[model samples]
Target: MAKISLRPLDDRVVVQPQEAEEMTAGGIVLPDAAREKPLRGTIVAVGPGKMLDSGNRGELTVAVGDTVIYGRYGGSDIEVDGKEMKILRESDILAKVL
Candidate 1:
């Protein structure tokens, strides 16, 4: 994949969402409108850590190339270089796939 040009500020990150499943477990093909939004993605770009009151930047646990699960309704969806991506705050990310 081509590299994304966006740089998120603070505790935000850029994620390339995984495509929604095209078929059901029962072998039924799903139409676009019937497919659920994907809740998992791979991190592409990460922002600098959020500033802290102690005159130091707080460290972020996640990093680029991490596969993470996020909330279904979290983050802003955008298109970068004709590719769909999500920009989410660090808080929006739920868990990292080990």
Candidate 2:
């Protein structure tokens, strides 16, 4: 696949979601209908942080390549070079994966 050139605007981030596991830990294979949409992803691209009312931009805690977990139904899905990606606000991010 070609490199992605898309960059997000202020406070927005472009995430590359992790693929869902086809099989459970118990070795049960799940069908497509039984699989849940992944809420975890790596931060591929990030915006220049949110603009504050004080006229300064707030710093973003997460950087590129950071694996983060977000809300179950957050973000907008986008396709780049045939790869699925998500774009969402920093607020949508729930936790950083260790």
Candidate 3:
């Protein structure tokens, strides 16, 4: 894959979604339409921390290269350099994969 030039702003992050499952546990192949949207992804880019009330930037816990799980319907889908990506607010991320 080509390197993406996108840079998110203000606590937003760019994620490269994991590929959807192609087969079930029973070894049944699933068609594309039957595949579920991926909830897991790797952070490709990160924004500067969000602005805080004290005029200081609040630090974000996640960073580039972090693998995370997000809400099922959170974030906006986008295409960058012909690759599908998601732009999510820091708050939209559910958990960081250990």
Candidate 4:
């Protein structure tokens, strides 16, 4: 298995998307293309906070090692240290995994 580390800056977050399950309903084993991209991810790193219009930094809601669910069209994909990772602005994350 491959692993990665990231340090985001200025209201950004480093996330690794969680892979979807291999099986489907009615006992069907689905292939990679038959599944939808998971919108969830693990929070690898978080930025300081959002910069306010007055230059004040807001509080951050997400933390490192937290599992999260993000938006479909959000985040920028990149390969870091030979592994895939996503660099997302904090606002792009939709919710945290329970």
lDDT winner? 1
RMSD of 3: 1.1
lDDT of 3 by residue, 1-98 (tens): 34589989889999999999999999999999999999999999989989999998888899888999999999999999888999999999999999
Clashes per candidate, residues 3 or more apart or on different chains: 0, 0, 0, 0
Best TM-score among the predictions, by candidate number = 1
Candidate 2, overall lDDT? 0.91
- Tens digits of per-residue lDDT for model 4, 12-78: 9888778787887788898888888778988877888888899899888889888988888898998
Find the 10 residues in a row with the least total lDDT in model 1.
1-10
Q: Which stretches of candidate 3 lie over 4 Å from their true place?
A: none
TM-score of each: 0.96, 0.92, 0.96, 0.83
List per-prediction Cα lDDT, in the order shown. Answer: 0.95, 0.91, 0.94, 0.83
Error of 4 at 58 (Å): 1.5
Return the candidate ranking by TM-score, descending. Answer: 1, 3, 2, 4
Model 2 alpha-carbon drift over 4 Å, by segment = none
TM-score pick, better of 1 and 4: 1
lDDT of 1 by residue, 1-98 (tens): 56788999999999999999999999999999999999999999999989989978888899999999999999999999999999999999999999
Error of 4 at 53 (Å): 3.3
